[model samples]
Target: MAGVAVAAIPDDIAETHKGIVQLFSSTDDQRSVRESGQAIAALDESTKARHLEMQQSIKELTGVTNRMLDELNDRKSNLLDPTTKRELLAQKSRAEDNIRRMQEDNASLQNQVGALSNKATDLTTSEQQIKQREINEVKRAKHTISLYANISSIKWDYSSPNVKGWITAGAASTGRMRAFEMERGSHSDFQVVNHLWNLMDSV
Candidate 1:
């Protein structure tokens, strides 16, 4: 027991305790450094993910731009000049207006054609009516001439000249309207042409 207590807590005891405290401080510092390294690695991973998202956004924007360019090219090919898209629009508007005017003109022409057809029909009807009246008049005169041939009569002296057109040689009155008689002499002043025309009209 004297040997054990003789050093009375030997000088190395304090030195040993100091060594242990330094060891624990060094271990805690190392653990802090390792956690900081892990946090830095995580930050690097997040940065890479954000960069990938930005690249995808750029790709989508480029696709939209390419589509717009293609549409512009298609419209450009249908025109004569590429520098005048507005001019092309104006020309298209003018063409539409001209088409509308042509349609109106076609309608007017159709109406005129219909009117002309109606006028032609009216003229034809009137001509037919006049022709029927003229035919009836001619028929009446023919009947008068036939009746005059059936009878022998003495007629008064005619005052008109040149009755030969209505009076034939040896003519006779065959009806009440007949005025000429059988007269072969050229000295007869015959004007039965007027009387025959009047009789035909009356008949």
Candidate 2:
């Protein structure tokens, strides 16, 4: 058996495969993925800190409100001065207002945290999809390479004495005489053409 000139893969396909490999294997893509993870971690930490701070503020305000209530209750049986009572009531109202404002701030903070969390989730999903696409492209490149390798590895028996007889028989059986002729015409090397003819005849 003799080897024939192998057809190379098309330029466009080769370029596409090269591009896919470069895009997935590049350091930039890796760095971007890492950055996304770091950003998510930072967001989580910020959210936790905000939550803890809000809780602490609410706790302190609640304590002050409770103290004022206790004082009001203690003075209820006594002849409390009107000014002192009004002052205590005003202080209580201010504390309650501060608590209400803090609660609203906490609610807004939670919404921001949720939005950041959703963004992180979307980033993660997009990264996974990109990885999947890279995997698929690699598979396609390998398959194309394998297919071309198989096509290029085809061998023919050019030196065999029975080649002509086999070709006639193959043509009669397969009705592919025209295809054989075209293949023969495509080759510049006479030996390669003979080998191809022999190979086709045997097929």
Candidate 3:
């Protein structure tokens, strides 16, 4: 309002302006504090958000790890289905590896959060709502082990052209959905590699 008043008045009256605009103007020192505070707040918010994401991912992957361990224990009891048995073993390997990686990721995020918290000035209470929202979303998504649903549509034949055989791709992209075993990662590319290594020995 003060700026508008100054602009609205004619230049001839500019020097004679007696309104509080000229008197109440903010100092350069105060403006610096306001802008710097805003910037710090934003950076703090983003850093916390990132830390929260890493924690959630780690938590989910830990659950996945434990599930894989249970599955391996079950397999030790009996190999009810030989085909599925081999696939399960492969998945177990991947899950164990993923869990280890997630642990490291979790630690890294925690370190970052601690460092940033020390630098931030009285902003600890900020973004509590955002952190809770992220936690809920991550928990819901990570509740289950991720498996490719389209593998059912794929058929594996002994004399297929490629070592890993061919896949119909299902709804996934032509190069994506693979016919390989579940032990392969969610994407078929890694599964195809597993097939080459395992199928030869199985046959």
Candidate 4:
């Protein structure tokens, strides 16, 4: 098949070109859409990475806050100088403020993650739909190719009585032969006529 030019017969060349162009053009469109989907997928990956980093940061901050609280509790329980007690209270206040800020940052990042998740889900659904459409288009294109490839091989079933008459009198001379054979009383002749009739009716 390499280097062979497959020229459609002149009779159908124009229509064939039109069909092929239309069919393949969608593939280009699908490729473009897929590129967009890939970008979105990349974004989703980055968003996930950022989410993980934020979660780790929040965990570390929580650990720091817990240790600071424990130290503050210990300081409160022990008898200490007034100056030391005030210093410990100040340290506790600062720790609580840092914990509050960390909690706020975590909440904000969680919201962002939620939004990103929704965006990712939407992109995934769109990508799937696009892929499905591409699949359907390819199937249709293949069917069109098969139809054209086997154009001469197409089974033209004549359903109209007029068309059936043509089959009996003209193209399908086998039907007329079957009619002639019917006089011999072989049931097979009847079957042949019936088969032809079925073919006619199947149109």
Which candidate number maximizes TM-score? 1
Pairs of residues clashing in candidate 1: 147-174, 148-172, 148-174
List, residue by residue over 93-161, the lDDT tens digit for candidate 3: 999999999999999999999989876734554567678877785455333212221333434554644
Best by lDDT: 2
Model 3: CA > 4 A from native: 1-27, 79-203
Instruction: Quote model 3's TM-score.
Output: 0.26
User: Residue 36's C-alpha lDDT in candidate 2?
Assistant: 56
Q: Give the TM-score of candidate 1.
A: 0.38
Ranking by lDDT, best first? Answer: 2, 1, 4, 3
- TM-score, prediction 4: 0.34
Q: Evaluate all candidate structures by whole-model CA lDDT and list the values in order.
A: 0.59, 0.60, 0.55, 0.58
Cα lDDT tens digits for candidate 1, 1-203: 01111113347854764565566557758775566556655765676677667667777787888899998997777565656778878899999999999999999999999999999999999999999987886567445655663432223344544332332224243444344443333432234444554544553
Tens-digit lDDT track of model 2 for 1-203: 12223244569855865565566556568876566556655765686677667667777787888899888887884437787778888999999999999999999999999999999999999999999987886567446534533553332244543222223333236543322223322433445445554664465
Which residue pairs show backbone clashes in model 3?
Answer: none
Model 2 clash number = 1
Clashes of 4: 0
* Tens digit per residue, CA lDDT, model 4, 80-195: 67877798899999999999999999999999999999999999999999999878865674475345325322233235322122223334434342221222223343364454
